[model samples]
Target: MSRYSKGISLLENLLFFWCGLSLILSIGGDNLVIPSWLQVAGRMHPLMLHFPIVLLLLAIALLWMKEESWRGFGKNLLLIGANFTGITVVAGLLLASEDYEGDALAWHKWLGVVSLGFSVFIYFFLDQVANLFRLAGSGLAVLILLTGHFGANLTHGEDFLFGPLMPKEDKMIALEEAEVFRDLVQPIFESKCIACHKEGKIKGELRMDHLEGLQKGGKSGPFILAGNLDESLLIQRIHLPMENEEHMPPKNKLQLTEEEIEILRLWVMSGASFEQKVMELPQEEPLFQLASNKFTTEKTYSFAAADEDEVKELNNFFRKVKPIFPGSPALEVAYFGASTFDASSLSDLKNIKEQVVKINLNRMPLENVDLSFLSDFQNLEEAQLNFTGLKSGQLEGLSKIQSLKSLAVSGNPFGEEGLENLKKLTQLKRLFIWQSGISESGREELKKALSTVQIDFGFDDKGIIYPLNSPKIDFDKVMFQGTTEVKITHPISSVEIRYTLDGTEPDSINSPVYKEAISLTKTSQIRAKAFAKGWIGSEETKTLLFREGMKPKSYKLTDEPHKSYKAKGATTLFDGVKGKANHTSGEWLGYTDSPLEIEIFLEKDQKPKAVELSLLLHEGAYIFPPETVEIWTGNAGTWSKVTIPPTPQSTKTEEIRYGLLAFDLPQGSFDQVKIKLKPIGKLPSWHQGAGSKGWVFVDEIVLN
Candidate 1:
């Protein structure tokens, strides 16, 4: 045989071998695992796929050519085309083995396989059967086109080419107008599940894009057994662990939120009815509340949309402008970063005043005069001035905004008189006056004047006449050398401050009332509480006082303090000053997700009577007293644990109080003392942030 002929025969044999291997792999693609090194090449199938397309088309064109020279070239072109098609099929199978499945994937796979088979036949036997070659060539062209279309759909998403041409409109309807099944349930399936279970991509042979398909069920049978969520396959798959193989939407797709899952559960449990309106559901039903909150339409205004250029120009880092909703013409303007707020900044929003339906200036540094521009926003429906400087007579211009439907002035010093000006805003529906100077009586009077408006005065204080406020401690240092007098005062002058020095919580009858400064000469744990008529007693405030002794010459910490709250170095522990209730004041050293270990060294050997550590406990902020505190004392290499304090029980309510863990040492001359404090590794179940690491805060450590 000639050298060229031998080379052609070798190439043909190689193509046939590859074509057979590709077909076998494609059949078992779902169970195959491509090696990590080959995975990258497999993923490149999409990028390298165009090569086979061009080669196949070139081979077909060459066959169609009337010229004898081009006809002769068709044989080599078919050989190249068959090899390209075989390799593409193999790459595609490797890519498909990695979690890719469904009807679309199968269709694309088999169609490509068929094209490969046709290419093989045409390459080897084109000369033997002319009519058969033409028929197979035409069939291969159609199969290639169909495979490419399905492949694009699987990679780029369904209807990628035709989706843009369809008319777009808001599919969401108001909760009042939405039906429980058609509007609420169907949309969720379409967004999260239908992509895999639709007609062409019916994974598990289950269809969800239509009601009839859902009723007909899939390979495993009916997804929903009416009125039974536990038996429903749809609910079961959604509730599965995200890492589970049977989990719906897969791990990478958008999973259902707790609320969305509950909505589906409630809908299925309610007989899985297809003709129920949301309003028709029982008012007390949980589904009714979820539907009302999720699907309710926002209030609409008839105002025109603001000029895009003007709105764009008014927006900056400190100022924001946006439409009220998806297709609404009304605009909402808000200001942030109070430090950058200027009085004249409000005037810049004048261009969109006619379209402005809401304005939020909460916590902004704008004065009363800056609010003068509010009168220009005649269409304003809602306004928030919470924590602003604007007070009483300053809101005269706000009264001109008759379209205002809701107003919030919480946390401001706006008194009862300031609220009277808002009575003229007859359109107002809700008012927030919490933390304002407006008292309970003032809120009642305002409610009577505006009979139709709902006035919110924040959470009910349970009608407590005088809710106990934190007591003020007048002593600078609870740990002093000789003696120090500490004075306690309550916020309300009429309330009596009672105290106990034995570490027991104070009571009205048992604890002595404080009349003047109490002088302390020795170490004591002072616990105090406020007592008043018709009110709950204040939280106990504990303080540790120590008689000063030899100061630690140097100290070393096992772990560095967190950078955010590293106080003035290790010496801050011996500074003799107590930190405020606020743990983030830079006075308290905070340790999170780790224990704190400290060793103190004295200038001379001395046997300290006791070692006192002051810690802050504010469970709401994830700050808890150390789970266990181990104290050790020794010289040089040998050390012995003096004591290990028991862990205190976690409290239910959030209370800010000081905790002192005291460890008494035995008679021994020790120069070095070590303290190991372990924090709560995970918060208790009662805590809102359960299963999360708790924080440990230490202000000062006293040695005497």
Candidate 2:
């Protein structure tokens, strides 16, 4: 024998030994106690697998190529390929001991062993069984292909090889034909929970992919109890706090959205039915509304996009111009900051007149502006000119805009004469003329003039006084650099919004009526209410505003915030973003048991006069005011502690509120500031979790 053949014989013997041992381990893999080190080795199987596939293909080609000269070379290559194949099988067997399970894994593993055995057999019997060697070589190739096919399915999911060529399934089902479980509940499980709890790789031995496995229960208990959310395992796991280890889909995985969880909860409450039709449920039920919204198709518009640079240029603090929905070519324009609006703002939009489908010039101080340009927007479908100081004559100019479908001229002084101009708009479908000095008799006449139009007169008071809804205040950051504008709006037309900036309640007769956005350059409290002729004023809406000072160069946290509420890390406090009452909105940094200690560095020229901590208070949620807050101001290593009064605790349960705690700093010019908040270590006696450690949630820290 040649020297190379002698080496091949030795490797062939080791291959035979490894193949036997790999088969034995794989057969008994179910009970094997795999260690961490072996798991690390098992993960290397993917990286080692390509070598055997490429070498085996080359070996078979060389041996069957009708060239005697290369037969010895092919034999040597076959032994090396067989040895690598044996090692790959061993690695795969070790991997099977982990979370991998299912029919795909089983088939892939056994087919790999068979391929290993076939390669070794072809190598040892090549010369003695020359006639069948060619056929065996072809058979070995088929085994390798089948093993690879199954392995791909195991890793990339079923139909990985030909999923694209298959017909795509439409996810949206009509409300009448949709089954409650198959259409709604099952999809939520497939997207969020099934990956870990499916047939082959069952975690906790629970299978959520189908109804039978879900009912069989897992190691924990029944997945769900019909008509009982309290005892259901699925409900309990999802409701657990995100910090808990047993939370479903895991904290690290894609957490279930609030709406998705609500769907699952509703499904369980409805006896977890598998064949219920969505439309069969009561129309007033929340589940029906959620399903209706899911299946409703959005309106599609056919129009080319506007120039990108022009859209960006037109969008500003006062005016917003963007696509109505993501990827849609149509655009919607809304103007804010009425004090800053001018005739040029409307004229400038002529750049992309064709793409503008909706224009909201609400409350834009447009009394004498030339709205003749509005007729140039040929595709305008909706126009909201509410409370824009529009006169009776301007309605004639709007009538020239032939494409108008929905028009709102509410809160203007125009009477029935102006309302008659809208009769020329043949395409008008809905008209809002509330509080326009047009009485019910005039509205009846206009509705008769345009029989097809739906005229909305808004809130016929009927001699009974109803309280108005509170005005919505729109301003994200409570702290501002130089000045901030706060806009207050009420949905009802012609209702007056009165406000006070000195923290006192606003009487409708005395307080200034809100028209434009309020500009603030100092710390102030704004209290507002809605007022009208026959309606009761709304409950007061209070907002605390602060003047920001000294932007932080950087900051560091002494202890980590809770994993679920870490809002953009150390920069969260100084990022000029504020969180609302909801703590889980990804804006607040929540800390429990530990003090929130932050060291902030400011610009060299900044001399902070005061410090403000924007915090949330919800006794029901176990979030309380800090016991005390300590602040120190200095640069370098010199520090002076500033004494502040203890923060008052909630004496009883109250609604969720966002409050500002301000402290005047000692007179100094300091670039470095350290703020430490000591959380109320334990909840007060009035709280439900009285003996447990409470939490303190902070959204923004202001230095002024």
Candidate 3:
């Protein structure tokens, strides 16, 4: 029933102050573009204080408004604020842990603890404080007022505590003139800014590729503002050096020269604002992506920077350093720039690992380079030093690389003698010593010492000249009989070929020499490669195979009455055949459908001729006179078929027909003759597979 007495005016004032402070905090958070370091200090300090302040206020309000009848809720509120005060203290410590040198910060933070204690004490003794409410509330009000004043002074100077703080109107860069940003500004950044500050691919998310990116910086905020160089963070940073935390671009990254720093300051004072138009640097391919395209060029590392001034400066230095082209499979790196090397420049090379395969130390300060540096490049496979001061001692170092495959020391004075130590590089293949200090006699000595290595200075008339030319061989061809043995003959002799008649080149150590009389079946070819010394002859010959003098190993007669079954209804035998089937030329008959297929065994190579082919004919049929006995070479068509002229053969020549004769198309092993026995009349009715008797008897075929 009794409200704590006195001071309604003071309580209303404190409530209004709290309301005002909250409103400014919310609004300022959105519109204010403050220095990043200052803003971080501002936000972090307030955030650390807020929970305790709000909770304590709520706890106080619990007592001011809550009745004792409401029991423990007021006490609970006070306890919650007390627990959170510890958290507030921890956060406050962290915020102050960074660059808070002044004691004002210390005083302000301790005073906050004092106010929190007062709030807690009042909460614990609710009845007594409630009875003296107005007096206690006045003390609380004074505490709050002092805390706010102190915080405001820390952030915006003492005058800021008096009223709503308004900023001076900022003159921003004209929207239309951003392009001026590139020429007047970006070049300065590229030349002196990006090495450590702008490259995002480092410890921080920093990049200096654009104005917008610079505006939204990493680890730091927008470094400049329009027309206020003195107020710009960028200007402030440039004023710092190696020891300062806010140093422009770190000092290890070449600091901006004094004159360059002055340009940046002037640019900032000229509204530090970017023109709407800016010249964008040509988009260079990313070093990593570019190096990955070719097999030999590899990008090992890219140290990207964020500060525009540093990055721009770094680009100049980067362009001068020789790009090392690296290789894969062989995994080597080649330093191809012949520019003079200095200690500092060579020091950069120490960063490159030993995977370097080649280096062009031509026209460089090779004399100053420690030869011991070469020892680390264990995988150096090739090197070229056309013009340099490398001498005998250096050659000794170079010779120690075991993986060296090709080397050229032309135009360098690597001593007056040949590289005696070079014999250690047994894997070396091509060596060029045209302009090195090695004399002709010395080179000859090296050749004798390393005979297998192909050393070249170009063609020499009297010296041991390597014959780059190799002779070509032609394996003529092969043909064989019934079995799968194909006869192959290469016109070029002494050159051995490992051939597989199965169509693969011969690689077996025991590729048999093609012998004569091979039996074969099915379509096949003999593929061979004539190889001699280092000259690998191309596939020298391919032989077209044919089944010749083959006894039927298997067959299913498609026509009836098989023996001496002279073909009938023949438009003309061998009509579409490419060549005229001359009856005078000896040839054998090839079958379309058969009851028996010939499977013969022969020496699986070359060909066999002079076979006596005997057939048992019925001899009781329409006469078959000495028909045209033709020979077919089995060309694409029957181009070469010879005929047999009848002589005074015994009985069956003119009398009864169908009698067997020991016959042959006498020829070489490469020949395939298809004999045709055309019917004198429609075949006699005894034809076998054709369900007719129109055929004569044929059996006991002996191919000798």
Candidate 4:
């Protein structure tokens, strides 16, 4: 209390008071129920979560000024600080649990756990259970500095810690004996990052267990920026202001100590890199199995290896990435599917044409492999090989195909000077040149070359989207039944109606033109697609010939009971029914109660007769059964299932609005019509719980 008393300026008093108030109100331990409005705020990225952590660490440090500073007051302050920290941890945990991937976030998690641990220990000390406040406080600051620094690296990359240093400041340390990424970076990360970013609960989806895993990036994308640490997301996150929510290690988790911060900042600024100077990847022997085999099977498309070792590396990398995409259980299918990887003609790709989607072989070995194989997997999306031996010369082989969307050749010796080959690919979407041998001049040259194509190649999130002119239609729906001839209209001139009768996409040849005399009773969903080719159709001016004459086909009642009954049939499970007014018996159903289900079967006697459907009942007798009815005629039916609704809720049932369904009939009498109810949960009724037990009854009926 003395320490607090000494700092008690009006402002300090308010701070402590506010802290105490927060602690007290938050305990509200009385309610067993969690608050419904509970929400924690932070930018979605891991950088945002770091803010509170930095402040919390600093607040905790303030609790250890001196022994005479506050007597037992230090203990109380520590307890309050712990409470705030605990809340922050819980919130952070919640945020961390969201879906994300890549290994960069692995470091962020470790930093958090260390911070959480410090807070937990600090809690014990506050209760007079531990005699190490000074030691613990100092330890907390150090842990914070460590965790915060690493977490930032995982988000911003290596440059964040060590900014660019001139030749004067970089003192080359003696080279070590042996160098292994797992042995080096992994330890620093494990020691500083493994806490929260570990497998089970990584805050930003960053994990640093092994080498290939490093190839997998954080949520923002790859972490290494290939070979250039200066441009990596891992470093940028660390340098952020402590108050900025985007600060790494997350402000809520911990703060970077000045010493640790300085060390890292210097490291990154000096062109942070890890080099044991071992033998370069051999250009001759196959380090990666680039050949496609029957064994490679991962749905992300296909996995290519730079060599046999690279195959194993990709196998591991894919395994790590698989967890990132959930609900896509089929991803493992790649492992079970044919392995399209072989050592011969590494780029033969006869085996992976349509199968592989993502291929990762960063920094692997391979010089000449025809990239022509990339064309086969029209679905090929992501290709990464940073720091690999492949140069821009090989990229030209890939540029021919328009489907290759995301390509990263960063950190490689590939100079953009030879990027002319890429200009032909109008579909080139995301291209990465970070840390590559691509000079500023080369980059500019490549851009100048691609000035004609619509390419989103910038590093920032900003996207330049140019809307192209294309053909379009302006209609909500198309009617296939009664419409013997539909006037297919489009805003674009010289458009054609290429429709498919087999429910396939409409194209020019597979489907005949909708000439002036078009006829369709055989097609259920006849697509009166208006197409001009170059653009997607618009709705306002486009028209699909709708045959409103197409109505619900009254089903033939099975056996019909055939004879007309003297009284109307009605049941009481849900809605109640009265007498049938129209020629059909559809008025005999009561649609109420849960399950909100209603089934109707229709039987007809005549062959080749088309009929429309309708339901009727006495004004006050039957209503609401069809508030929302889902009617389905199994496959082969001429029409799509539909929802039928009643006019309104009231005692008046006679003036019942009609629920009509229409579509071309099969030119023959049908025996049964089955209508199924669904999706809408149990319907609620004021009658069952009200004065008069309201009831709606129904009966299957067909109209001709």
The prediction achieving the highest TM-score against the true structure is: 1
Our model 3 lands, by Cα RMSD against the true structure, at: 33.2
- Each prediction's TM-score versus the true structure: 0.51, 0.41, 0.21, 0.21
Ranked candidates, highest TM-score first:
1, 2, 3, 4
Clashing pairs in 2: 609-704
Which candidate number maximizes lDDT?
A: 2
Q: 1-704 in candidate 2: lDDT tens per residue?
A: 99866876789689879888887887777777888998888888899999999899899989986788787778788888889999888888898776667888789989998999888888888988788777888999999999998887776557777888999955434445567899889988887887777655677888877788899878888888989999899999999999999999799888999999999999998888888888778878888767765652223455678987788788777888866533346788899988877777677888889999999999989897777788888889899999999987777766777778899989998886776666666578888878989877877778888898888888876778678999988875776678888999999979999999876799989999999998888777788999998888999888877676567888889999876568887787877766766664568888885889999888887777888888888776667888878888877959888888878777887778887788898886777889998888765544544445667899888887
lDDT of 4: 0.44
User: How many clashes in candidate 3?
Assistant: 103
Tens digits of lDDT, candidate 4, 1-704 = 57556654433344444344333433442232324343343223344445555555555655655565554555555554555454454444444434323444444554555565566556555547346666766777777676667655644554456655624332211112223232233445655555555443445656655444455766776666644556766667777776887667676755556544544443344333455221222223121111111111112212332232332343431222221121111111122111433335334334434445566655555467556556665656677756666756777657655666677776666565556655555466667766655666777776777665443333543563432233343333332333354344445457665654443456556666665544554323344455555645322122223233312333232222212221233221112222333322333333323223323334343342333333333333223334444444443455444344443344322343333333334443344335432211222322211121223333323223
Please list all clashing residue pairs in model 1, or write none if there are none. none
* Clash count, candidate 4: 124
- Candidate 2: segments with Cα more than 4 A from true spot: 1-122, 125-149, 155-266, 271-309, 315-332, 335-358, 362-457, 461-502, 506-609, 612-632, 635-661, 666-671, 674-704
For model 1, how does the per-residue alpha-carbon lDDT over 607-704 read when each residue is reduced to its tens digit?
A: 57878778888776677878777888878858987855586756784667777777777776888899888888766645554555667888788777
What C-alpha lDDT do the candidate models reach, one value each?
0.78, 0.81, 0.46, 0.44
Error of 3 at 32 (Å): 36
Candidate 4: lDDT of 666?
Answer: 45
Cα deviation at 694, candidate 2, in Å, is 22
Error of 4 at 554 (Å): 99
* Model 1 ranges off by over 4 Å: 1-202, 207-227, 235-473, 487-498, 513-517, 529-549, 602-604, 633-643, 649-657, 666-671, 685-692
